[model samples]
Target chain A: MTDETIRDVLTRRGLSRRAFLQVCASVTAALALSPAEAADMTKRLETAERPTVIYLSYQECTGCLESLTRSFSPGIASLIFNDISLAYNDTLQAAAGQAAETAKDTAMKNAWGKYVLVVDGSVPLAQNGAYCAVAGRSAVSDLKRAAGGAAAVVAVGTCAAFGGLPYAAPNPTGAVPVSEIVRDRPVINISGCPPIAEVITGVILYYTTFGVPALDHLHRPMNFYGNTIHDRCYRRPFYDRGMFAKTFDDEGARQGWCLFELGCKGPITHNACPTTKWNGGTSYPIESGHPCLGCSEPGFWDKGGFYKALSTPTGHWSRTGVVSGAVAAGVAAGLSTAAVARARQGRAQKKAASADSEPKNPTS
Target chain B: MPLSRGVIPIRPVTAGAPAGGALADAILAEIASALHEYLDTRQNHVIDLTGMPLSREDRQRIDAYLGQGEVSMDIHALVHSHIEETAYAGVWRVRHYDMGGGVHSERIEIIDVPEIVRASSADMAHSARRIEALRAEEGA
Candidate 1:
């Protein structure tokens, strides 16, 4: 492996250290880290040994990788390429067949127990794990083996984190997520249909510089996936004001009203797509007149129709039932609290009356 | 009616602010410097809108981008003021009132803590004196 410093790499790539440092600062801000941490991250990026990253692809369409390559910012692209030693990427690497396998083997051996393993697709468990294979080995086996030698595993798309479409109803391949397969190592899921390019790079930068970032319950980085898309959406004011588009071509739609009635899944989806944006902060789906499909959430495919409003109850749970249940719970809580208070009051009164009647020792 | 069709009608372009959010983009780019400064130094920046050549539409666009937040205050000082905190913390919209109760000066102020809400030194001194008087009267 080449031992070139990040500064040396940037210099070779015709990028200034100042510009790269600025990019680092921005990435830190994007990760919601404090300015002090941003300064710390800048130093880490500048001086740290560029860690080796082995990217594994399984049952996926390669859109996740494409999103990274199609990133509009040259500074971001250079930052990613120069900051890490991406050893094995089947799509981008020049080696093929036996040579490719050999290169991956060499890279793994060289950076064993320290390299970051990035998986982009789900692993199929059916048919003895034969659905998706690399180098004649199943994804499950490959992931397990690589995870054992990895410092951490980053599941980079919805497919790898959740089963995604592959594990939707009538799942033929019996696909399972990387987290489910690799139980030993810490897995950081960056879920999206094809996650925003900045998010992908941001996660990598944060992990490499600051170790594992604060993760939410779903093991996703809290800074990126902490808030629902609705919380950070620019169109959220319309949602709050009860203005929604009923149809695609309606006046409300043209006026850029909320798409809740038109089946925006922003309320359920947790990702930085709304704030961080896609295609180099150009716009997200909701900004482009389309509703969010809730791509980041687990079992999104099985969550009924994409165009059906989230308020429209499905399965055994009706909207009325949910409301009634909440109301009943509230009433029950109030009744219980009142009863407890009355009981306590009764006990206190009884004690006071007894003391007055039996224990009046006057002037002794 | 077998005919060789040569003419095809294309949809007419809608005359508006264009497809992309150009105005929003430009405004955000303008505020980018302020944001960077705030992030870097935790300092406050105040931009007086009255000094700028912004139309009502431009102001509305800026408001939409800023979004309504938790805080909105109406102050009845010498000049009545309406202050609103934007969705993003450290960003605020403040407007000074005129004699006729219309907006005299409007500004988008970015700061760690807005100075408008804080008590002035003179006010604090007066408050201290009042407290001392109250304590004396109460035989403290």
Candidate 2:
């Protein structure tokens, strides 16, 4: 692909700078940056040379790719033509077989050590990486080759960041996240069953502008994953009031009360679902009355049942009634801390309310 | 009768703001603080309402509190951008609508005039050159 800067693309498309600034302003929100930085962001997006991206898919269901196409802000087309030159993606590209392979090879060579390497799906390490392959080469070897010349790697979706469903139990392929193989490079994980569309867009925009953004312990961008879903959930008041939905059809459920009793894992599952939301800001799983499956975290598939209350330990714990020993401990610790904080906040608010309502005698 | 910002009713806040206004209350506080920050630093700021859990009530409350101002702009590009100055002089409510007229973003910006409404120097320069060239052709 030709080295076309954003300015060149905009000018050629007959779009003015003001219009692009609007997009930049919208994207500023996506970056979790204040509007004060909109002008700065606009300048960077306008002037910076568009980066080439090589998307590598592995042992996955391609849900991540599907989710990416649903991006609203800078929708997939805008992100592709305006912000990035998506040099190669097996699913998106038209050139197939040898021509497609040649394009990837050419793009990687041309932008060596400068291109953004985007990987979806986990890498299979077992049986000499024999589980997933393309053109007689394994996903593991191909990813290492792509990572060698990449400026930074973006592991999109839970599958590539954490061994997802394929990595569940009785592992045959011995699937591992991209970070395990691409050790020398910065692998930014955009983890979710398939991360929220705008989040994927936001991370790409941030990376394109500022390079690797701040990451959490799992190497996910802190900008999008900073707060736990429960922290920002609108139903937090109900949670504070200790009102919970015991069943799917209960009055509390209709009133949109806390789903903690019904196996909602918003307290420990860190994601932007509550904020950015899904289906173009419509709603997320929790908002739609389903308990969180903890799709973003590693080993979520094996972390007990989806409807089990946190640490109640009496209900379901996966079909086998067995939880990964480590995950159980971690969940218990996070839940206890959250419970304490909730109780303390509730008490403080109650005390303050009481003080406010107390009628006072004539002031001195 | 599609539900939109315009269609929503905004009851005026007369009783010195409501009690227990959780999310809505926090947002108003942010806007109030932003108004002051702009005054001190002459810097514009934006609060992305879309990124927050802004219920319909929260949105109306913020609207009722801010009221309305004199300036409102409609700029059409990839989508239709509507920017309206709130009751507070520098505070603006910016919303972008898709082709289908669905509101994509709802933001509160504190600025003299939002950048989206202002024509850039580069665009003006380009237009200026084009106008001059037109004059030259007429003279020729």
Candidate 3:
């Protein structure tokens, strides 16, 4: 609450100066900046002010917050997210009811026009925004008031970034992403079913260090989302060698071949899961013997079967078979891959229907 | 059980890019270029090894190529770190390990010494003050 620098807080809070440098080095490397920037960043961050952050949840599972906070494998670098966060989320904060509401209001008022607004989940506009309410107030109104004085809006998950699962076909609640409402303030979308932990931290650290980062057309930070899973995939050589895994238990599957034939959307999806990885760089989905679900991309829940390959028909490879995701969006119209997508989608629909029909009441 | 697709008899690669050597060669080439740029411009470069798709064989090739230098040290902080200078003078390898002993972030730097090794000015000042207080208490 005082006018102390970030380093002062870190030191006073028992985080060593060297540990702070380590964090700076890790983030600098993650940003793909020169190694020298580590020292420069270390110096700058020592004097940099810790910005106030306010987290707002609209319509989401707490998975995005779970991703940000590391319970499985806690590391000092990830803990930096907590050091600067003046977060007022009901889930993590102790206060509730009027006390919690008062704290959030007071914090926002004091840090108004200066706090970083981090929002997750989509905001439903249907039913007069009655689908989701906090303290008897609609999520839409809460979001509008909070965003009114925010320095910047950080959309954490696909729900907040691109109206995730709730915004799928039929969209019962008429869910709209944060960018749709907070258009006045600059919105940084970190879209994922739950984005990579480091990517979220990396984006925030980059913002605190050097204003807003360079964004792609999706308004996502270009540094982390620049390369697709297909681009940096370790199985890429297998793909280029024309060795494809047809099923989950095929010989090629045992041989660590490309899973493009098994419905991998890596060809058209952009994310840093391949690089930053999960569970602390242990392994990603593709490496763990599963095709990419493209969970980070928009409309991922509505996308076809997770096991359908993203390639053309058998025998020969076409131009559309191996196009980069950046260009794949425009080229999807005439591609034969679309047919496979539709067929797999039908199979997926059937599977969902059968599952839904299963007895919900075990006694019945 | 009825199989989906015809199980094509997979054969050894008798065609395109050489297996195992391609990625290692690419990394080696990157290091070589980075080393040259460092020598010529006195600029430092870092290649994030963990981010790359390096197999066991690729790792062996890179390890054998770089070898090991005389200077190697372990740093303990929030995360344990092992840093080793490669046989090449200006090239160094940095491995940051999580508390769980899994490799978190690994990279190669073409610098005099990795920045993480250096003591920060704040720490140095603290050290000086602490020692000064100790000496004064002893009436030296």
Candidate 4:
């Protein structure tokens, strides 16, 4: 199977075999795949025919694309574009005007029922979808046309997955996500304001190897987005000690205490920010002394103020209150008794010493 | 040396809010009364006591109790009020106390009945162990 030999493919791409192996290792760790599974994936990825991907951009700032381009180690961008046959990308494609549209048409026709549709922005549905038009076609029309025969659709950012800022309050454009438009196909939502770069590449690698990565109810990869940020927050000990940062630069904040009172969305927000971090896993919002804005979860924009504390149930404390009071009282009493006893012992020791030193033998 | 001591105010720690009419109000009143008793006893102990260093066992017991959230302890009245207003459906007043030569205050709020009892029971067990340790230390 010429397609199965990844080592040969990398050599063909002018990348050393060692560099290709390193990429494979990174993909395995990023996807949390076992070593054996990773080896299998490496084999499959090296040899499989490069899948076609069509990328569409709509109402967005292109931050997601920018984040993707910033993938640090071994440069995932070069690997993705060079290894995969990315047929159409509005931002990166050489063709434009009639040529670009015709290129998209030809790719879809040739790779029908095989291509992967990747969307990076939200589609505005208001005013008969006149809010966002590409090549004189509404975003909704463009998306539907692209999705009709694609094997899968990957929503690459918060905008493409949940309408992000475009769908924030008022939503002048009446923006909707690609999933709403492409209901017929399997739509995977890789949600984040601009998701972690590693996570984005990891998802692509999983799809490239295993056909499709396991997804959560929200269509996010379960391995990465399953746990809340609070579960792995470094300052959890301070929170347990009841130390919280009340203000931006208060003593607690300076001490690197829990940011719960400072409107940290870690407890409620589900993402790998605490674990995966940002800027090549160097630091996340919480670690840098700022509270999480929960940019990854759906409807985060509408979920009250960013600094407001979540209405967590205090029921975990009913028993705690009584038990702690009694314990405190008992311990206090016991400590007092011990101190009194120790004081008495010291006094007695001094008396004995005085008695021994008395001049009773002075007459002798 | 600065004394590591604090005072806590006494407050009624009721469980949940009143449901609707007279029955709910009565239940709330009952819970408040029980919480008041617990707080009053604890305060009396604090007042009668003088400069005594807390033991490691005592601190551990207090930690265990706090973990259960059956009672809320604060070093300042402001923190107490905040806990009472935000965490519990009850009222409380701050009281100051002298610790050795230093002075500090705490706000003491009663947790709901069931949780308080459970926590208190665990605390009592811890206290028994501490009391035994104190007895041994005195003998030595």
Query: lDDT of each prediction vs. the true structure?
Result: 0.70, 0.74, 0.74, 0.61
| Candidate 3 deviation (Cα RMSD) | 11.6
Model 1, span A24-83: residue lDDT tens: 534654565543455567776776656678898999999999988777653445356534
- Candidate 3 C-alpha lDDT tens digits along A22-139: 6666676556554555555666677666767788888999999898786334675446677566557777888989999998998888777877889999999999999999999999
Which lDDT value does model 4 have at B71?
41
Q: Report fnat, model 2.
A: 0.40
DockQ of each: 0.02, 0.25, 0.34, 0.01
- For all the models shown, what interface RMSD does each have? 18.3, 5.2, 3.5, 27.8
Q: Per-residue CA lDDT of candidate 2, range A89-134, in tens?
A: 8888878999888988998998887888889999999999999998
Q: Which scores greater on DockQ, model 2 or model 3? A: 3
Sliding window of 10 residues with minimal summed lDDT for model 4 chain B: B44-53
Measured with C-alpha atoms, the lDDT of residue A342 in candidate 2 is 48
What is the Å distance of residue A5 in model 1 from its true position?
3.8
Residue runs of model 3 more than 4 Å from their true location after superposition: A14-16, A36-40, A71-73, A311-364, B1-19, B29-42, B135-140
What does the lDDT read for residue B94 in candidate 4?
25
lDDT of 3 at A348: 48
- Chain B TM-score, model 3, reads 0.80
